[model samples]
Target chain A: MTISWMDPHTTSKESRSCIDCHTDPKALGLGAGSLVKIKGSWRLVPATSKSRDRRLNIPRLDGFVDISGKPLVLTSRKDLRPFDAAELKRILDVGQCLICHKDFDDKVMKNWNSLSPPKPCKFFLKTR
Target chain B: MKKRTTYLLVALVTIGLDTDSTASYYLGAKIIMGGNNSVVECNLAKVEVAGSNPVSRSRQFIKTGSHCCPFFVQENFYMHPRRRLLTLAILFFSLAFHSLFPCTAVPPCQAAAVDSPSKVSTTASGQIDMCLSCHDERPDRAHGRKVLGCFSCHLGNPLTGSAKLAHKGMVLNPGELYIVSKTCGQEGCHTDQVKRVKKSLMATNRGIISTLRYYWNESKDHDADLTVEKLLKSDLDTPAIDYYRKLCGTCHLWLKKHTLPGFLAEKGGGCTTCHFYKPGVGKDGKKTNHPMITKHIPMKNCIRCHNRSGRIGIAYKGIYEAEGYGTPFEDGDVSEGQLSDGRYIKRLEPDIHFKKGLICIDCHNQKEIMGDGNEKAHFEEQLEITCTTCHDGRQRLEKIFEEDIKRPKYPLLTNLVKKNGNFFLKGKKDQKLHPLHRFLDTACRHPVHERLACQACHSKWVPQCYGCHVVSDKSKDQLDKLSNKQTPGRWEEFRSFMRYEVPSLGIKKDYKTRQDKVVIIVPG
Candidate 1:
């Protein structure tokens, strides 16, 4: 069965493939379940649980290999292929990349605008 | 020729007769002309003639002459008679003049008797023997034999009754008296008495002198210099030292010789010697016999007669004569027969009161415990021992509250009122009232609980209370028991009462506002 994405606050068009919106470069760093479609039903996951699930799916299999030299996996499933740089950028923009990892947020890392850097944690999570 | 010659001879004889008459008269006149010496000679010659026959001598001389010469010779002879008679009268007159007035030539008979050797020996023997009979009869009586005359020994007006011999017989000079009394009559008479007096506590009065000297040295030099002169001129004329010398010295010297226990001899009683009771009213309304009695009753060991609590029996309420008066009893117990109306009178116990043991020096001695085992000299050192020494009232109460009662948090209040007008209060109290008010209220409210007097709380700083209340080590326990009910709350109540009545009590600052500000701002 195919999943379609929809915005509940607005009457918007739906997509047949989940990758059309979920993998879109502009929607990558947006709300976690904002682009997901589940069997014609559209519901957003809880903010804290969505962020935690997104953290588990770190490697984009459609993109090049990460610094670990292992093949990048774009999907949460184990068997996904790597994608090229143009496709990766189209899938994850600079804004999206910056939001995905704490190190990429120049303003937060440099403490510019008096925003303190995120604190370290035993579990991999950002702390203001 | 014979008649003519006879006549001529008679004329010559007549002339001779006249010449003899003239010569006789001239000698008589010469005798008159002479001073008293010639008068004496004329009188002597007339005396000789008067002793011879006057008429016969005259006639014989006349007949022996010749005719005309006979008449002339007879006349010469007759004139001789008359001249002898005249000489005799003049001699008698001269003797009368000499008898009427005596010259310095001879002394009167009365005067002669005094100058006689027999009289001189008799007068000397009478006066000397009278003095010797009484004074020089014995060897000791003849103290200074070399100077034995009345005038020499006595040396006073003979008219006045105060001649030394008349008054005291023979007073040796001061220097001589000092030597003879000290040496000649040494151990035999008063030497031991003198020694005891010297060692007695009275003799140990050097402390007063030392105190006076210390004051003298510490005072301004000018003021100290005038002390002697002021003391001499003052009504108290005798200096402090002189009082000790006169009152204590002579008696101590006497005690040194006569009394046994030489150390205690000089300590013989003074003012309190005869006046045995303390100076006050006894139960009988009569003045107390001894004026120096103190509050150290238990220490005085007064329990022998009075109750163990030192309370006397009701029978002793009035002045009773000392024990053993009309009774034929011994040991202060009365005989039933001696009692009036067949009633048995209880006799006062013979306790060791002032007469037997208590002496002024025993209490008044300096307060410090001298390391040398001698009594301390300084007042500061001596007064350290107080009523609290023997009485454990406060300590016992505090202990009860702390250990038995289990009130460890109970407050302890120690208040000291100084003579200099300073009050020190240490404890917690409500902020609405002053510390003094709180103290007084606490003290007065529960008088039974805090039975202690104002003097008891204030005595540590103001020692003048001792003038009335005398406490010693032995009496401490009794005093504590008597004051056991005294508690801090009673003192607080007394303070509160004072504050309500007298609002200005204990507010000493110049301005009330200043005190308030200090109290509010200061942490303590």
Candidate 2:
């Protein structure tokens, strides 16, 4: 029997919400940070606290996987590993779209792929 | 001298025991001694004590409807006038005592006492069930009164005239798992099925308990040696076990049906949970027909318990349980879109299969619902049929073996038939022949969708509950479902950010197959 150790990701009340898996960098397997769009591409902005785990070679508290998709933590199961960079980018792109689209019933999302490449949203253009 | 005294003592006790007859005897004596007009009033109760030979005259009164007075009248001939008066006073006192406390007397028969003569019935197995004397309604065609008698399903004394003896070991509902062996599982009837059903995950609740324990970190793996049966025998309190007992215990087959309040009362019998035909009440609010045991299960039976947790039962029917604020108030009042359990819901597009009149049983075969006599670790492992099973790219029904039809795990044979050289599946609920449509060529051949499970795109929306907080308050005591005792450590769950939208995509890799497939994932 495993001892009563709280994996904050699962057991704690402050555990990640369902959306956090798509939006949060840590949940996407890129160590604790915020996803910021620089130029036209998504970039991972690492947290200011630079404390590192020398053993795993990533940030001590937040590192589950690096941006290249190599696992930093010992995964319990072989089948269930963190999202790779490509998979993370696809999910984050949708998360970014959801900021303005709000729901799937939006006309743009109904035939999203049929349309040409999306132009930068009003918020993204303002930030630029 | 001793023999005379013994006879006198017996006569006095007999008068006391038979109160109705003693009352008649007192009235007869009073009419004889007092010469009162009550003789005309109490003519029916008059027990004539002739001045002839007392022994023969008492026998005459018995033939003439004397309640009881033979012994007293026979003894009265030898006793003096004064002693007779004393016996009358004793009889009067006994009559008063019987009237004062009628409940203390031997109870009258309570079983349905038919005014007509007893009806005799012989079953197919050649046993006479006396229950046919009153209850003669034939059940289903299979379990007819002429075939499996009332005693076969309902065990009671079948050879007795007395109602109490006839109903001695009677079971009100024989489908209860506790005493099913003597009824549904008895020697020649449904024995193998009863055995398999008891071991099924629905009955044992093994998978649910083990999976919860694994998620709570109480177990190393999802496959744990925990079951509802074991918990019922002996309780082991951990966070997961406690939470499951308090919340998820009602939907198992081990529960006695109709014990819970409200619509839940119709749920969770061993066999009747799925088999029993639940009749509805008339407009006058009275039962129109008796509930019969049947193989043709209705969708409502599945929906009764499946309407919570996954909420798939209602989701298939286009009912989405909205958050409890009861939004979109009707006429300044709460919304009318509410479930029987009082959960607020909204209308949405139902599943295509449901809109086309397909039911849960049409997709989930008997093996998926009822186990194939194997103890599986999870529901997915036990589930045999998939979307590909029916909607194959090959454009034909899959090969169904003879053994599959015999054991009947693959029930598609019963419903699936070929007509005019075109394959069709008969809908289990609607009894309509639905054409077997193969997968579209474009979708089947698409390279990008190769790893995707059908539900990834086909499933429009899934109910997503976010930030579920389970708090275990040790100070309070909660009712443990397994033990049925108030145990310490109350567990409460709070959920917020409920949304029904396009599901998040996740990859589920089968380690054995080494195939990673994309599937819908919802928050726990």
Candidate 3:
């Protein structure tokens, strides 16, 4: 009898703090990088100079896809995808706001999604 | 004297004696309806005539009971050939129109047999249940031989003496959804529950199939004609459908018990899938007499099939199935972190409910699991409980306590107890009283937090499979669990990467509530 097993996904219980998902580029499927603003545009500064895979010629295994949604792994499903450039920018822009506004009760953080809200962060306007 | 005779007939009807062979059932009804003033009583075990001023021997009829006389009762009656033929014609018409006038007060007559038992073969209702003669194993307290007997759940001809005749239409497992109406859904039994469970998502599997078919571009929308019940009937084959039949079909309630191989054989026996519990032998190696069939379902029952797919079952208990590298060999030996089904797992922090030892049924009530007789399309639509329902202390705590009161008791849900003029929900499994704290309004009253689902912030992590490649080989044959036959096409899936991390966030627009909520999204 041939004994085989299959379960592609499982989870641990240690939860992510606010900064782990919001600020970290690797956590958001953008690879290991530091987010910085250069000339009114957000640019990812690579943390490590890693070599590409010789066989597939794709990015390293740790990363799923780049900020532009160009897949590093072979994804056959149209529904299963990584964050696109616009989505990545939107998430990182919030990360900038979170740096100054640590607490959720902050007036600027409370009305972040509202239309005529307080703009406390100078970095948010640069991305917009 | 005539009034005494009328009372005996009324007592016979009230006891629900199936005296159709004695012809008293129809005669008693006819006499009661006609309001006959004349006293009439049959001779005990003999065909004797009764005159208009019949002797007050109606007490003897009551004393002799169901095994009384087989005489036709009429004014100046005798055992004549033409009179017997007329009685037979009346019997035929009564049988035809019996349901029109329902016997509201009468209990359903238990199946009975002739040959008087020398040893053991009689139910509590004084009926000869021939099933107990051969298969007389002691059942649980709730479904004792004296109470339900063997004939209640397992429908068969219990009146017959011959084994062949008795076993003619015997159902092996009455919990199977197709024949549940004849067994569990019997008039005075769980008729309403059976009706509701048939429409439940667990039996129908509407949401799972619809989402899969929609993702595969086979359907325009997620609400399509794809359900487990529909799939079992049709022989249609598509890429997504074929994959679903071979893989995902084992979890639903329609799957027959003992049909599949290995661990799968234990899954999906309708009501018994969740409710059946077989106790182990005594510590002294003595065999236990009974197996419990109860509403108090354990965590192991829910986790049997729920360990796969979403992996919510395992996740609740802090067990994570990890990659197969034997993971950081300790003490000069590979760690034995394998499941009985041959999967390697690592320990993680369990859910808050699991840490406190609350079982699945403590929060999830009958309505959420069995459904409310509505044909819902998804699990979210079927599920009624939320974090707010329990912890928020504002929404559904009172309703949850009321639902728990209805369950059968041996081991009661001690969680929902009133202590010192205060209602507190203790953990059913752990027996520890958990404090229900309302959401802290100091930090939670922000506008951004208003539209956020609890799981968006609180859920630790979700399992992520980046690229899952499923390859189906048409040359090989594989066993279909639903059909129980080996058909063409063997399928296998290989995942490129697996990771556990913070789930991606997405907007869920609830059209019914008119609320735009941010919820955690796990990519399929």
Which ranges in model 1 have alpha carbons more than 4 Å from their true place? A1-128, B1-203, B211-239, B248-375, B392-524
Q: 1 or 2: which has the higher TM-score?
A: 2
Once superposed on the true structure, which residue ranges of model 2 sit more than 4 Å away at CA?
A: A1-82, A90-128, B1-119, B280-289, B329-336, B394-413, B510-514
* DockQ for each numbered candidate: 0.00, 0.05, 0.15
Q: Candidate 1 lDDT, tens digit per residue, B1-524?
A: 12221332244344342222222212222222222442243232232222112222222223332332443332231223444454343333333333354334332211111111111000010111123222322111122221122323232211112123133334332112223233222433334433433323333433333443333243222112222212224343223233223322332212222132323232223211211234355444554332332222222222122221112221122112222333434665564332222323333322221213322223222222111233333222223323222123434334433442353322222212222332222211211211222232322233221322222222111000000111123222221111112211110000000000000000011121222110000000
Q: Positional deviation of B23 in candidate 1, in angstroms? A: 99
Alpha-carbon deviation at B276 in model 3, angstroms: 1.0
In terms of docking quality, model 3 is incorrect
Top of the candidates by lDDT: 3
Whole-model Cα lDDT of every candidate shown, in order: 0.25, 0.59, 0.59
How many pairs collide in each candidate, listed in order? 54, 0, 0
What's the distance in Å from true for residue B251, model 1? 9.5
DockQ of 1: 0.00
- Please identify which of the two predictions, 1 or 3, would achieve the higher lDDT against the true structure: 3
